[model samples]
Every structure is written in C-alpha cells, then in structure tokens.
Target: MTDQPIRVLVCDDQELVRTGYVTIFSAQPDMEVVGEAANGLEAVHEATRLRPDAVVMDIRMPLLDGIEATRRLAGPQAADPPKILVVTTFNVDAYVYEAFRAGASGFLLKDAPPAQLVNGVRTVTGGEALLAPAVTRALIGHFAERLRPGDPSRTAREDIVRTLTPRELEVLEHIAQGLSNAEIATALFITPETVKTYVSRILAKLDLRDRVQAVVLAYRIGLAGGAA
Candidate 1:
C-alpha cells in the first residue's frame, strides 16, 4: 500500500453509531477519519469538500438517503469519485442493492466485526469490490428478474461475450458467483495472482469499474444466474 494513511468519511444519522465507526477506523494505523456526517446532504457536501479516500455511508438518513448521496458522489456522472463503502443494518436489504447501483464500491452489515469494517474500507480504497459471498448471493437472487436475457442490450451482451477469451469468461463466471480471487484460483486450479491478472483483463476489456459491474454484466449476459 501507499505510505499515506487512507482518509475516511463516516456518515450515519445515529450519533452513537457514527462515533463507534470513527473509533474503529481511527484506531487503524493506516487510516485517518477525515470527517463525519449525520445526514445525506452533509455527507455529500463533506465528502466532496474533504475528498476522502473512502466513505463509510449509512443507508438511512435525513434530507436525502445514502443511495442518492452515493450517486451524487460516485455515480456515472461523477468525476474522480472516491470509493464508497455502504454500512447498513441487515433489515434494509432492498436499499443495499440500490446503493451498489448508485455506485457504492462495497458494503457491510452494521453489526459486522470491527476488523471486517476496517477491511471493508481498505478493500474499497484499493479499488476492489468488498461483497461477502452471502451478500452477493442475496443481492443476485433479489435482482434476478431484472437480469433476464432479451433486453435491448442484447447486442452489447453479445459483444462482451465475443470480447473475452474462454479463460476470461470462466473468471467472470466465477466472479459472478461471488468467488474471491483466491477462491477462483482454487476452483480453476491456478494461482491467485493469475486470477488477479485475468480479473484485471476482464474489467479492462469490458470497461467495468469493479467486480460489482462485472457480476451485473455476467448476469445480464446469461453467463451467471440466480444463486442455486
């Protein structure tokens, strides 16, 4: 990693929750809590102003919601967006998917262990998607209907298929199935570094920002299906 500590912005409506997050993140030798926000509007404003390396966003907030705030900070229209790590209570599973669609790089349950929270920030900051396997399965299962074939993007899907080599396609399929680089390596009997290379090539060839989009593309193109 870089010598600079990762800058983090914590946003949560609950003061107690925000404090807890700050404490956990600030304790990391490689992290610095740059700012805090109690609502979506403040989150967007502070995140833009501070330009933190990563944002720990809450789903529910006053004024606006985390998803919209994330969109404002990191969506398709955004320029030089920072990585966003959405933290939420498991009760809001529906909103979690929307947060990802709005350009969040990763997410975690609010009740996850402190170490997981720390790792989530670092994962996003490193330009990696930080979805747990179970979360990935749930997300794909919840959105399966929206990913059916025969969409207007059929030609684009076909082009994507034609663009990737057979091995790259295999890597994409494993990624869509919520497999991490190491897991994919084991499954394919290749080294994890090799899997990483393939992942990079796949993203570059497909013009995807991260694994989240890769999973979405795999589903849309029939390379993956709802979790079994």
Candidate 2:
C-alpha cells in the first residue's frame, strides 16, 4: 500500500462482492484494497493483522455476524477499534439502525456507485460518520416513535442539550431530520457558513465526534423524536 492511500479491508460472504470491491478500490489513486475476508470471523482476524483505516463489512456472515464483529472491532467496549462501514444489498431500514448501534461509521448499499463507496471510506477515515439524509430521517423517526417517556437518561441528554444555543438546537433538529448544511441554512434563513458553525458547535457541546454520533444521540435522548 502507498503511504498516502487509504487502506481498506473488504469483508463479505460472496466472492464476487469481495472481488468487485477490490477491483474498484484498487483503481483509485487515493485508496488501496489492503485485504479481503470471506466472513466476519476472518474479517476480525484480518482487521487485527492489517489494522486498516477502514473496514467494509457486510451485515451477514458465517462464524460470526457483522453486528457482533463490529462491536468487537468498533464498539464502545473495544480497546482499539477500526472504523467500520457496513455494506449491504438490502435497504432494510432496521438493519441500518442496528449497524449504527453497533458503532458503524457509515452504511452504504452494495449497489451504490463506486465513487460513493470510495467517498464513504474517506469520510469515515477523516473522522466523520456518513449518514445519508434519508437514512437519518428514518432512524430518528423510528427512535422517536418507540422512545419511552421519562427515560432515566433524559437528564444526561438534557445536560448535553442545555449547552446548545437555541439556534444551535434548531440546526441540530434539522440535522437529525437528515437535512444537509445547505438545506438547513435555507430553512433557517441563515448562510450555510453559519449553519456549518452551528454544526461544529453542536458537535463540541454534545461531546460528539461526528454526525453519526449526533444522529444516534438525537435518537437516544428523544431530541429528534416526535414532531421535532
């Protein structure tokens, strides 16, 4: 691998899928397909060996599943975990939500364009989580509809919430809705620059590292639930 290439490990049960990813990523000057694994177990083993910057793991596999594998590799309990980007053919919304809960940095459809796949890796490697706007809305809605009232963690969530200014909260609500910075700016009648600032501040105040965590926190705390 080149010193500057983004090293990636492709893990899937299907040989064609693995080969396809290798071929696509190999063609990119900024990326390198460092290794391939046929199942979650192998994925974890190879991840430990290669220590790649990003792991492209599928949701299903033998010997172990991606969810557990992701937790071992990137979960809150992990001592050292690589960023995981889940790859799946089915757009089943629930699986996407579970992937995030398992600490995935992003989720990309298997049929997504090669460019998007590459970009997904780059985004996660750059310390950002890739949440498509549509997916974001679905997750927030799902959590909002199911969240129990008077949650014990409500206080902690509120403590984090209080740090946000009213305008920052507005931007955050839009973010939980899966709105882009440009869309948020237009909706709030502010410049996109201001919206970006709000996003940065929100991340800082909430102590979240990226948008994916923000999205998860929004659901965890009922901020993005219900009408808002």
Candidate 3:
C-alpha cells in the first residue's frame, strides 16, 4: 500500500450522517477526509476537484441524486473515476442496483457499524468491491435481471465472454456469486494463490476493470443463472 493515507470525500444530505462519516474517516490513521458535499451536485463538483481516493456517497439529495452523481463521477464515460462507496439508509434494491450500474465500487448501509464503515472505505480504495455478505445476495439478485435474455446488451455480452478459457470461466462464475479468493479456493479444491491467478487472468482476458465488472458481465451473459 502507498504510504499516503487514503483520501476520502463524504457526501450526504443529512448533516448528522455527513459529520459522522467525516469523524469516522478522520479517526482512521490510514484515512483522511479530503472533502464533503451536502448534495449530489456538490458531490460531483467536489469529487472532480478533490480527486479523492474514495467517495462515500448517499443516495437521495436535492439538485441531483447520488446515483446520477455517481454516474457523472464514476460512470463508464469517466476518464479516471475514483472508487465510490455508496451509503444508503434504506435497503432499496433498485437504488443499490443503479449505483453499481453507474460505476460505484461498493455500498453499505448508513446504520452499518463503525468498523464496517471504516473498513469499507479501505476495502474500496484498495480496489476490492465491498459487498457485505447480506449486500451480496440482495445486490446480485438485482444484478441478475440485467441478463434476462431479452435485454439488448445480452448478445454483445455473450460474444465478449467467448474470450475466456474454461478454467477462467469457472473462476468468473464464483466471482459473480460473490465468493472471495479463499472461499473460491475451498470450493474448487485449489490454492487461494491459484484462484487469485485465475481471477487476474480472467480479468485481463475479458478486459474487465475489476471483480465487480466481472460479476456484472457474468450475470449479463446468463453464466450466473445456475453457474453458482
């Protein structure tokens, strides 16, 4: 890891929640609060200027919404998007799904324990998607709908997936199912190092940005329906 502490931008409409995040991040020796935004539009502007290592985004705000802001800051069109970790008070699957589709790296509940909040920023900034055990099942369940055979992107996605080897494809399936390297190794009777190697190879071969995109791709091509 870099010697510099992770820089973070905290965005929320609620004054208390925003302050709480700033406090939590400030207390971490490995993290620093670089900026704060009270609304989504401000979030985009501040994030653009501050270029923080990670963004703690809240879903609902006036002027713009967190999902749209996340899209603007981290969307496929962004030249160099920062890692974004969306924090929501409600367990709305649609919002969570939209956040991911818009390019957020991860998400957690506003009521998540302090340790979870701290670790989430670190996890996302370190380039891992931070879907908790509970978030994974719910989020992936919503993610699966993007593959419903009738979606327009399915054909192209299917063609793109043809690049993977059989072994890489197996690894991709486990990733989409939210299995960690160790868990995948256990399930496949291989070493975690081997699983990590396969994961890297799969990402390189598929031209994926990270495991999150890999999961989306797996679901889009119908590889996740029963592949898990």
Root mean square deviation (Cα) for candidate 3? 2.1
User: Model 1 lDDT vs. the true structure?
Assistant: 0.87
lDDT of 2 by residue, 66-184 (tens): 88888888887766678899887554556766777778888877788988888888878876575466755765576676654365658856886678888887887788777878889
Candidate 1 — which pairs collide?
none
Model 2 local distance difference test score: 0.80
Model 3 error, position 109 (Å)? 1.7
Model 3 C-alpha lDDT per residue in residues 1-228, reported as the tens digit of each score: 989999999999889988888998899899989999999999999999999999999998899999999999988899899999988855465687778778888888878999999988888887677468456766687657655644555675566567777778788888888887888899999999999899888778877767777877677667776422
C-alpha TM-score for every candidate = 0.95, 0.87, 0.91
Backbone clashes for every candidate come to 0, 0, 0
On the 0 to 100 scale, the lDDT of residue 95 in model 2 is 71
- Point out the worst 10-residue segment of candidate 1 by lDDT: 219-228
Tens-place lDDT digits, model 1, residues 85-180 = 998876787788788779888888888999999999989888779477777777667777776777556776678879999899899989988888
- Candidate with better TM-score, 2 vs 3: 3
Off by over 4 Å in 2: 1-3, 139-143
Candidate 1: residue 223 lDDT (0-100) = 70
